[model samples]
Target: MKQIVTHADPDLDAIVSAWIAQDFLFQAHASEVLFVSRKVPEKFMQSADCLVDVGNRYEPENYRFDHKPPAFENRNSTCATRLIWEYLLDIGVAVRHLEGLVEITYQGDTHRNSEALKQSRIDGPHAKLKQLKAEYKDPTEIYQQMAFWLRSYTKNL
Candidate 1:
């Protein structure tokens, strides 16, 4: 089994990142995958063949790298969504499918502060995500819908 491990105590951002990474693996590698959302033991991290979202953190010795940009490489960006999206993009995954998620994370990490939200111009994508979050709808619903689509798409290929 392939395990995609999220950061310890993952939030929505982490979950969304995991969802995308999971899909990328399914399409590019194989469909049998599981995402581990808990605080994974270092023992498990060392032992399993897993993809991890360990941002600005230590790299597990055994897992082969598909693509992981170093933290110093992109200081302006926060959150795993951008990192995961960029990695997928490099590997030829159509991450436009995840624009909504990508956007909201940008908003949450950048403009979510009181001062930034007060500014007249939030970036268009982030602004749209802000509006979506305002509606009190679960963001997971969108990713779930995409997961279904990606599964069928992968199987067809």
Candidate 2:
């Protein structure tokens, strides 16, 4: 099975990037989501098929997507989710419809205030994510729930 690794207590960027990797990158195969520390261990660095929002790496050719410096010197404009989404698009994946999702994730990750993002926090995926975080202790559960919700959101969009 393919493994998509990310930091524990994953935020929107990590969860969304991992979700994209699972639902799009490895759509034809089974993938496991593994939560590790922000400082990813050497074992996972070498073993995981993809690392998202962690590992401090942004080499998409190697399937590692992260926006934290020094991986990204200027993180104000991008995040892990956007990096992964763009990579998928480059590979001819049908993900143009997810541009909105990618934009919101970028805004949240970069702490950019926007009317659309603010509205989303009121009742959109952002709201659901906050609720899920409060309701679940396991990060994996939160990711799974959000992944399901994202899949639905994508389909309906």
Candidate 3:
């Protein structure tokens, strides 16, 4: 299936990055995929199969390319990650949370808090995650806890 992504601004990078990772997973499974974005940077363009510019069209209703209706929405300060996460969930992609973060890995690869873990000695959030890890024997349990937290987090938004 062709996956079209529309970017309104640079802030959507993280969501786009996660989608790229998901594309990689799909490609590994021998699925055909395409990425379409407006005003995409050179770095991102290199990774995309097709690129289009929607120019000054802020209204999601006015957007249409390849004859497909655009899936557009305003994102929180985190940009499109939350919207992307919600879309993935709606589509039935199984995502598990880890330490209050959403993670989706089709292969053995996983999202790690390596940097956060290292910074834990200084940062409060990382320190809390570190403490949680210390208290739990199974890392999977942490993911479960994160899933619950994500539900609460999204609900309050």
Highest-scoring model, TM-score:
2
- Candidate 1 per-residue lDDT, tens place, 53-152, comes to 5524433234322222453354334556665676667767677666555655555654454443334136433343344456535535433444564455
lDDT of 3 by residue, 1-157 (tens): 4333334321113223333334422435432223334555555444443222222222222212111123333211222333344444555555434212332211101223454334433543334444556777553454334334434543443
Lowest lDDT sum, 10 consecutive residues, model 2, at 68-77
In order, the Cα lDDT scores of the candidates are 0.49, 0.91, 0.34
lDDT of 2 by residue, 1-157 (tens): 9999999988888889999999999998999899999989999999899999998889999999988888988867589999999999999999999998889888988889788799779987788899999999899999999999999988977
lDDT of 1: 0.49
Screening candidate 3 with a backbone cut-off below 3 angstroms (N, C-alpha, C), the clashing residue pairs are none
> What's model 3's lDDT at 16?
30
RMSD of 1: 7.5
Give the clash count for each candidate. Answer: 0, 0, 0
Clashing pairs in 2: none
Candidate 2: where are CA atoms >4 Å away?
Answer: none
Better of 1 and 3 by TM-score: 1
TM-score winner between candidates 2 and 3 = 2
Candidate with best lDDT: 2
- lDDT (C-alpha) at residue 130 in model 1: 46
Which runs in model 1 stand beyond 4 Å of their true positions?
28-40, 51-76, 110-157
